[model samples]
Target: MSDSGRRMRTVLHADMDAFFVSVELRRRPELAGQPVVVGGTGNRGVVAAASYEARRFGVHSALPSTVARRRCPHAVFLPGDHTLYSEVSRQVREIFERYTPLVEPLSLDEAFLDVTGARRLFGDGRAIAAQIRAAIADELDLGCSVGVAPNKFLAKLASVEAKPRAHRDRIDPGEGVTVIQPGSEQEFLDPLPVQRLWGVGPATLDKLQRLGVVTVADLRRLDLSVLSTSLGANQARHLAALAVGADDRDVEPDREAKSIGHEETYAQDKHSPAEIRRELIRLIDAVTQRMRKQGVGARTWTLKVRFAGFVTITRSVTTQNTVDESQEIIDLLTPVLAGIDPSPGVRLLGVSGSNLGTPVAQLTFDDVADERPDWHAATDALDEIRDKFGSDAIGRGSSIVGGRIRTIKRGGQQWGPDQPPSREISHEDDATR
Candidate 1:
C-alpha cells in the first residue's frame, strides 16, 4: 500500500434497505415478503425500485416495467409517489441529524456521517451505529444498515456487506460489520474488482481490463503516467488515490448541489430539427419551473445530446447573471445545437443549470404608466394562487406546449414533477408478479 493509504479517520456509511419499497411495505404489512416494484405506471414506464423478492427474478431499478413484468409476473408495481417517499426520507434524515450534524446525504436513501467526534459524547463506533439504527427504527419505523470503519471507502464497502445482515439481534452478524482499523483500509479494498471503485464506470473499466488491471491491487501497481495517458491526468490521479483507499475528502455538513439537471431518452431517435427544438423548449420550461420552485436562479446553462451511435457531447455557456427565463435559455442554446453535427440521430436530450444564485423577484410599481396594468395584476394573482394552492396551480400557455405537468409535494417541500405518462396503466397488478 502507498504511504498515504496507511493514514485513516473514522467514517460511517448508513443506508436504508430497499428504501422506496420498504417505505411502501411499512404502511401495508400484508405486502411483506411479496415482490414490489415502484416507478412509473405506464406502458413506457421504468422501474425505480424492486423488492429483493422481485430482484430474485431479475427485476431491477431502471429496467423497463414491461420487462420486469415478464420476470416477476406476480410482482406489485406502483407509480412512485415522490412526495410520500420524500416525506419518509426527510424523517430518516432528521434521525441522522440527531446523531451527528456532519451528515453528507448521497441520495434520499443513503448518507455518510462523520462520527469521529461523537465517540466521546456517545460511545465507540459500533455503539454509535447501534444507537443510530435503533433511533431510526424506533422513531421512523425504518430499517437501516450501517458500516463503521476508519475511512469513507472501507465504510462504504462494509455497509454493503452488512446490509443483508442488519436485522441481526446480537452485536455481531456472522462476520460482524467488517471493521477495518486505522491502517487497514487499503488492504481491505485491494482485492476488490476495479469496477467497484468510484468513477470507474463501464467505459473506464473496459479500458483498465484491456491493460490487464482487473483488481484494485493491480491498479495500484501500474505507473501513474501510463494510467494518466489513457484516463487523463485528473482521473488517473483520483483513481490512484482510490486504489489504495486514500480519500482525503471530509464529510461535509451541507453538501450544496453544484448543478440541477434533468434528461429523457426518447423511445426512438429523433432526426427532425423542428422536433428537437420543440423538445428543447419543453425541457427548458420544465427546468426553469424547477429553478423557480427551488428559489434559485442559475448563470450556467448546459446542453447534452446523445447520438444514435451512443456518442455523447455536452456544450455549456456561463452567463453574466443568474437567469430563469425560459426563452432566453432556449435562445442561448439554439446556436450551440446548430453547431453540432445533426446527421447523427439524437437519442437523448438533457438540460442543466449551475452557478446558482438566490431567486429573482419581479418588481411592480403602481406609478408605472407603460406597464400593462392587467398583465401585472394577472402576475400578482398567479403568485398568490401559487403560494396558496401550489406552483402548478397556474402556468403560462407557453409552459405546457406539448405535455401535462404534475406538482410533486413532499412534506413541506414542493416542486414540479417529472413528465407525466401519455396514458395510465391499471393498478390491479401493482404487486410483484
Candidate 2:
C-alpha cells in the first residue's frame, strides 16, 4: 500500500465532469476539444450544460440559449438526451459500490464516499477515489474530480478546487485529486473566503462584511455573540463549527425522493385556451402513466402556469378518490384549468401530482361510470402494447387531435414527455425523475 493509504482519509467527494454534455459527447467524439452545450434548442431554450471550452465564452447552465448564442456563436448546442444520461449514471454508481458501500449520492453526477471503514480491504480513501475515477473513465469514458478530507465540508470544497481551470488562491492542489491532511484541515481552510462556509450566502456575507468577518480565519475569531448578531443564534453556531472545519454529519447511504412530477419550458408563450387544454391533457396522461406504473396514487393535483414576464401561479385540487388515471385526474382539474387567465400568453404550463401513497382500490363514490370494465381493459391493453413495442405504437386521440403535442413515451422506461419539438423534455434530465 502507498504511504497515503497508510493513513486513510475519512471522507471523499467525487463529481462527474459536465455530466449532461459529456454523455452527449460520448456518441459524437468529433466535437472533442470544441465548445459544446446541452439543453432546450428553441429560441428561448435554456442552457443546461456547457463544456469547459464554452465556459471561456461565459456560457453556463440555466443561461438562456439565445444569450448563450450571443455569447458563443460558435458553440454547438444539442437538445439534451436525458434517457442516455440516466443509463450512464446508473453504470457509474454501480462502480462506486464495488469500492465502498458507504457511498451517498449527491446527484446523478456527484457523491460522497466514507472510505474510513474500507482502507484495509481497499487500501485507503485516496486509493478508493482513484480506483472509482479510473474505472469510470475506463468503463464509461468519463472524467471526474475527487477530494479527500477529514469531513464532508472540506471534502466538498476540495472537489470544487480540483475542477479543471479552477483559479488558485490558497490551498491549491494542482490536480483532479486534492487530499487535505487530517490534522491540517484548519490551516488549509483558514485562508479561504467566508463564502467557502456552507451557510454564508450573499445576505449572510453582507451581514458578515458589515462586521470584520471576511475569511474563514476571520470567522474563526468572532465570538458567539458577534456571529449571532451577524446571523441568527442558530446559524451563528452552525457557521462557527464549519469555520473550524468541524462537521459531524455522517455520510448517509440513501437520499430519498420526497415527490415526483413532470414540467416543461416553452420556446414561445402559449395562449389559446383549446391549445393549452390539449397540452394539459397530454401532461396528465404522461404523469398518470408514470404514477400507475410505480403503483402509487395521488390525492392532490396541481396545475402550474407561468406568464411571459415570469409571473407564475399554481392551482391544486383534492379529489375524493386517490387517482392515477388520466381521465380521473383531469376530471377533478378541469374547473381549476378553466379559471386561469391566459390573456397575456402563457410561457409554460405543467401538471403535478403530490400527496402520493400506495395504490388503493377506490370505488369512485359508488358511481357506476367509474367502474366501466371496458375502459379499464382498454387502458391495460394500450399500456401493454406500448411496453412490448415502442411508445409511438399507441396513444390517445386527444394527444394527437391538434398535432401540437409530440414524442409521447407510454412506458416508464423513458423520461421525456410529449411536447412540441422545441419545448420537449425528459424526466431523466432532472434529479426528480
Q: For model 2, how does the per-residue alpha-carbon lDDT over 49-77 read when each residue is reduced to its tens digit?
A: 88888877888888877899999899998
Clashes of each: 11, 2
- For each candidate in the order shown, give its overall lDDT on alpha carbons: 0.73, 0.76
Best by lDDT: 2
- The residue pairs found clashing in candidate 2 are 415-427, 416-426
After the best TM-score superposition of candidate 2, give how far the Cα of residue 228 lies from its true spot, in angstroms.
Answer: 2.1
Worst 10 residues of 1 by lDDT: 424-433
